[model samples]
Target: MPPRTIKAAIQDALEDLPEKKLDKFRSALLDRREEPRVKMNSVEGKDYITIAQVLVSTFTEPRALRITLELLREIGCSEEAERLGELPHEPKRISVISISQSIFAHGPSAGASAGRYMSGDKHFVDKHRTALIQRVSTVPSLLDELLGRGVIKQEGYNTIMRTNQEKMKELYAGPLNACGPDEKDTFYHILNQLEPYLILELKSTK
Candidate 1:
């Protein structure tokens, strides 16, 4: 496997702790009533890595790490959160902010969870890759639109049609990772139309 990125390194630290502490970490993450509220949940009995992956998917690396640190400190793991916080930087990428995205800005829990750390930057398709993979179906209609918009060609459309996992792989490898901002924006728009509730749910979580 490739070397773990800093974000993974920070999250994976939960693996070294006792199951009890990991439970607290997971609880802290799920308390939608709290600060740094991220809209996410891990199935009961999921492993630490699974919980960590869930966290990563719910926020950008910087925000994810920040929330992780605060939760760790809350659960009396300040030293660990501190150490993880020292990791240098996230690989820089250009962020495309558009006015059309404002549609998903308002969340259901805006009254309880609206805080400084609430995610505004995590709406785009690229930022929430794992969440989409986990929640969205094959979405052949979405694939059709992607093809119609030239975001994916015949071959990519066929490959991605196999399963959500395959679709996410193809999209990340071929489009979200390889294409420019315009294509990515198109993908996000298509996703919002197809999975409006899920998209809104995720956008509000951060």
Candidate 2:
């Protein structure tokens, strides 16, 4: 059989982490809401609580996911009320679905009692792989747009194309498939590769 790919290797590495570690992480995050807030002092040396920062964090807190949904509904209500000078005449119902496929595209799911962690990890890997392809699909269009707008000069167009083609080969169209590279790492790689060409392009424009 042919050798397994790098993406598979990375997935195996991530999945092979002891379940004990995951259990510990889950336990730690469970009570994270009760953790003491970080304190800071103003320039005058008076202690102050960053209420706005705390409120933003609270809204996005793991414990506040449902609350955030409700708050979004509240905001929509307020907007409509301001528009009509009153509340909605008809009650509107909103529903949210935290679908597995969608969450897996970004990271591991957090659904408890779903038995998904065991299988969802694999789904996450597949979704991550597909995401890399979707990202690569943007490279050509980005290049074309840059060329069309004269952002990337015609003389250096070949250089940009060659660099992007190499990236495509590294990510896809190769025996070594890189399907599961995290979005952060993929973006980092893109920035690293494109930085030099971008610098040269900007220099030419100056």
Candidate 3:
């Protein structure tokens, strides 16, 4: 028999869940502040199979399952993640929790690859990842700011939305990861506007 694909895994994971739980799962995916968010509407009245289809189509197979697991955790359905994990899977795809590193992965130092110096502002964001994750809350606003500043486009916004784990995590993984010094400056400025107190505290601690 072929190994269980992410779609099969999702069907299995959600098969036994009650209506309330399923609704919670659906709502967690849809709670993107406003305008329903891209691709979210497809899951509105979708069944597990359809929902899984949408996820697979949007984020590809591996990321689809990761997003499902994250959504399970987000909606207090952690046990669902475990159930999903128990299903047979494709060969050696990192087992479960295949999201590949947490939000604050101390990624490669900026200067390492190209021998280019990492800028001070970018360094600030990198150095303070932990504090930023814990303290930042004006996430939707921050995303808007980043988008308005051209730091991230619509696809970037949607990707971050799909990967649920405190908006800060998504921010780090999506746009912030690719941001240049000028973009990082814009990010920092937005932080000041949306999380003034937290930024102030973090800066003082530096």
Q: What CA root-mean-square deviation does each model show from the true structure?
A: 16.7, 23.7, 14.1
Q: How close is candidate 3 to the true structure, as a TM-score?
A: 0.44
Cα-based TM-score, every candidate: 0.40, 0.16, 0.44
Candidate that would win on TM-score: 3
lDDT of 2 by residue, 1-206 (tens): 66443233222322333455323322332323333422332112211122223323543332222222222223333232232212222123221122222333454333333313222434322334443343232356444433443333445334333454464444344322323323322232232233322222222331
lDDT digits (tens) for residues 1-206 of candidate 1: 56567557765678776889887887777874534455544535778777677767766555566566657876998678656655544232222223123322443222123312223464267677777775564266677776766667886444625566677776677655776554555566666655544666677765
lDDT score, candidate 2: 0.31
How many residue pairs in model 3 have overlapping backbones? 0
Question: Which number leads on lDDT?
Answer: 3
Off by over 4 Å in 2: 1-135, 159-206
- For candidate 3, give the lDDT of residue 87: 62
Q: Go through the candidates in order and give each one's C-alpha lDDT.
A: 0.60, 0.31, 0.61
Error of 3 at 65 (Å): 0.6
